[model samples]
Target: MRETSQLPAPGSGAFVFTAQEIRELDADLARRDLLELTMEHAGARVAEVIHARFPTGPVLALAGGGANGGDTFVAARHLHALGREVYVLAQGTRHELAGRMRRRLEGLCPIELLTEERLCAGLSKTRVVLDGLLGTGFVPPLREELTQWIRRINEAGKTVVSLDLPTGLPSDTAGDGSDAERVRADLTLALVGFKPGLLFSEVGEVQVLDLGVPPALLERHAHASCITPEEVRALLPRRVRGAHKGTAGRVYVLGGRPGYTGAPSLTAYGALRAGSGLVALYSRAELPRHPVESMAHRIEDWNALTALPRPDAVALGMGLGEDSVPVARRVLSWKVPVVLDADALQSELRGAGHDAVVWTPHPGEAARLLGIGTGDITRDPFAAARALQLAYGGTVVLKGGPSVIATPGALRVCLAGNPGMATGGSGDVLSGVIAALLGAGLSAPEAAIAGVYLHAAAGDRAYARLGYGLIASDIAHEVAPAWHVLHQASSEIL
Candidate 1:
């Protein structure tokens, strides 16, 4: 919720780690007593959420054999102790879970073998379906049976909560990969560290559960910008009594051709409202919208591009069209950090040689940039974002439903926001925030990290006021308040 412009780009929002990397982080946390403690904490957290929502609802814990399943047992035991009806469906044999995990679930609740018929019947009346069947160990393209079960759970409209990564979904961030299946959850609770799968996939509302993992350890393990409010607010500069318009940061937005001027205008407004001291729109003479506090300077020729103004950051590609192609080609040559968005997406975002950039592409635009169709990129946001990051040589912010921000080097998740943010023009506002942050000097990935959360948090605030009627402009207006609120919370913790 912190003002993203005030902070450096967040670490990667990918929860995914390579197999070897996963083993290392898990082992490290496990060695320090976090293995048992974190799971226990996660389970308890889920139990608390469920109990509060469906306090008296019969709980059916569909558990598997790994650590993910172990968390279910922990939660089931807690629920049972509180006198709630809890049933444990051991999807696999008892031997499947070994060591302390097995020991913890033993005799705590009624255990039953989850045969297809029994599973169906149990799911039929279950108030809360706790999916601990498969956690981070799950790979893509689930087996037929598991896929069927996931579908059933989805259509049944149960308040299904997945522990860690959703069952049937890949534990890695790539999501669905070559695998043809994924679990559609009502909620996914991330523990220890968030997985990239949740942020980019069809997984439901994600909630970051307390795993009791030490801040130091989590920070050490973090490769993405899953930073806390405190960390984000630390980046905001102190507004000394003596301040000038030129002191804050200068952002130059380019990429509006003859017809599409509103896009660039909106981006400029978003930056101005976001507290940028100076923002100039360096688009075709056609797009002339400007912030109320400032006026936009229009550029006509290519030679005037570099001569306009010395900007800290540049934003291009909003409402551009065929003519934008020639202009975008020239714009990319700029040395400053840039956010390639809207129509210029395909032309400007080449795979990987960028010095610093935040590429914003909708599914279709993403497809154009990657040389594929929209369906392919929409099918897997996590992978697409990563692909873009590697290809563009900078961070990629795959905008719209299940948005993802990826830095070529880091992996993390934005554990904020809601579903009420799918409105049009939202991407333009986001580009503005990101550009302003870059202008303020956060790295490419850092700007994206902050932008994702800022955009979502602003939407979350708008939801509180307008509900479904919210628009992109509303979200832009809400950013200032959200920033203050989040910043205040950060100040209190210190």
Candidate 2:
């Protein structure tokens, strides 16, 4: 198998556009007489990626009767020029194609009309399939004939590379609960900008390609931005040589009942590992030892929080259990930089008016807070995170396969985590990391972004060594190394 090339991190100003916005930009470029050039760039990039990634392979290009097909025809021509055996499967007859698409089709080798038998034959002979059957204009509830073809292509098991997006998937929303069948591509070449639908798992690995659209056009229509390592590096808190325990910021973790002590301990570990000067755990019951670097305190009442020395930041609600509602209320009233996770995410606490708060909730917890089903949260995490932020009046981190961090003005997606990070207590570690960053004086959004990146990067590092067997503790232990790597990279850049 050919090794996948590492996609360069998008610039900090990179923004994601909707399908309609992309179309508008396309029309705008067309008026400027740059549309054809953009299409050529897209085709060249697709062919070049296929040539580099698939190396020696017979490529079968599936073309529909649209601009998407035009791109496919151009790619097929380029692939043939590169000496690769290529086949073109056109969805319609040459007479059905129009204008640019028709001209592009005439440039290709004799194209075969798309049919079940021909598709099967093409699949059998090809090592890579380019899916140009649908682009960003696709809608849900795909036609039965197209669904059948998609199913066949998926079953064919060829390394399918989609031109813009997989066929049958809409551009507006992520997969959500749609019953429509879509082509499962191994890679998707996002033309010009990313669509929200590409954020899901079904789209596989995404590589955004520039289609020569001016950056200003994309920024004007962009709905959200992606989180990159470079952005996280810039957000990371810096420490001076003179910094000591008193100067490094203190984090107070308040959670952990009798049976769920592990959660609070992991949070403390995460805070300590993420560079908090001191971490103290205040739990309902304390019968066991915690991290050596962290102090443990047993709290009998909510009022105990009032007496405790004010820390720079606080992380609450990990395994706090059913009785945590009162404690959460008291803590929210403090108005210090706080990260609310797990049991602390109470509906009654919505809009608690904390000046600086970060809520880290998985889909289920987020649904509970929003009074909706978990499916709604999964369908469009961007909207869910935004809703959470609006309701709670703070930064919201909607944790998932690719987590969404929503601030007042921006929606950011973190794509660094892995399946191994889905283990229990993983979110507790994230909460602690965020709290640590907040304690170190970063804004809620800055801390959440940097912490989410650090936590995910650590999980990725642990996965490299321990594979699926890696646990939450492994991720916590890897935080220092992840931070060191990012810090080193940032230093080199400087």
Candidate 3:
């Protein structure tokens, strides 16, 4: 693992907004006395980001006719003032603050009305293109001219900096098209803050540009935060010199009948590796090798599981087959904080309200839990995660290409995992990691957030070394190294 935080804090405030949500935030902020000032602040921040990223360069600003275009113009003016050869390419009518910026930019730099021919010709000479043609409100099936321009710009392969969001990508949801159709930026400056769409793979190298939105102001408007590596590092359970087996954490992993012994063992191994001092696995006829650090106990039924001492954290359902429903019910009834996953979530929502329960489900399981189709869950994972959280009354980890963690008032997205983590036992391992955190005294939300981030970070590390061949076991083994990176990051900060 790398010995540093790959993802630094974007800002003190982190939230992923839908287009509508962003508009709402803007409206709420606009109601305050700082509307025009906010726009000005936004433009100034864009300029600052541009200058810091590529100082002293021949830069091209593709200005649209909206607020995003205004931001682009402001950046161009700033660059021009700093003695950089800045060019502004405008294609549409300038309106609102954009109109004001257009007049200002015309005084500072030549605002060229772009033809496709001119744009293609100009692209070869520019070092970087500030893409402000389309912003957060843009949707797919772009206009003919815009699409052609994006394609040409992408083909030209110049360093592109997008303002707010990449063109042709939906800000409200994940992009579902090939990269060719989307604006592939080298850097994306998220104005005011980032949204979920900006974190999409197509929107590369995101950095938050605070538009004078105070932390407290954002707190009033924002309901979600992008999980950061630094935050996860701080949330990890501290280790002491004389900490005993009981002091760290005790995690009980239960599941893995006949054909699925590996699942439970994987869960136990994950918990143990994630700083759990003692991990006990209760499996039905487990003969195959389990992690040596974890104690494996043979169990016939739920009665046998109940007979064992109540562990600090319980990981229920890896591969328990048909018995998962009863085991889940019996386990939840005991009032232990449980990380319920896989077959454990296969059953309908039941049992009295437990103090802490986390449901780790992929789209399929999430769909099943909500009685909706998997397509519905995949299409809007945020909504699905929220729905699952409301229905089941706990933190919901909606596992997907990018997992969404839904707690009561906040939703956090884990942008760490790759396609390499799509193997069978991956979710099982995640269940263990979360359980261990719960055992270590993190709140349900904190544990889910930290665990999801850690699991994805480990997968990313494993993928860096092993590529797509990374299996679930690789993810499990990489957990220790992942935590090491976090530890190294914390030490460096101190």
TM-score of each: 0.79, 0.92, 0.88
Q: Which stretches of candidate 2 lie over 4 Å from their true place?
A: 1-15, 93-98, 176-180, 490-494
Give the range of the ten consecutive residues with the poorest summed lDDT in model 2.
1-10
Q: What is the lDDT for 148 in model 1?
A: 76
Q: Which of the two, 2 or 3, has more TM-score? A: 2
- Which model scores highest in TM-score? 2
Clashes of each: 19, 0, 0
> For residues 1-494, what per-residue lDDT tens digits would candidate 2 score against the true structure?
11112222433334677788888887888788887888888888999999999999799999887778878888888888898888899876342222365466565566888998999999999999999998876766787889889989999989999998888888877674343488888889988777888775355677888766777877777778778788788888889989999788899999999989999999998999999999999988882857989999887876767888789999999989986678777777777899999998889887674758999999999999999998888878888999999899889999987788999888887767777787898999999999999999999989988998899889888988997788998999999999998888744452
lDDT (10s digit) by residue, model 3, range 381-472: 88888988887887889998678889987788876778778888998899999999999989899999999988988998898899878998
Q: Every model's Cα RMSD, please? A: 5.2, 3.2, 3.4
Total clashes, candidate 2? 0
> CA lDDT of 400 in candidate 1?
54
Q: What is the lDDT of residue 153 in candidate 2?
A: 97
**Model 1 Cα RMSD, 1 decimal:** 5.2
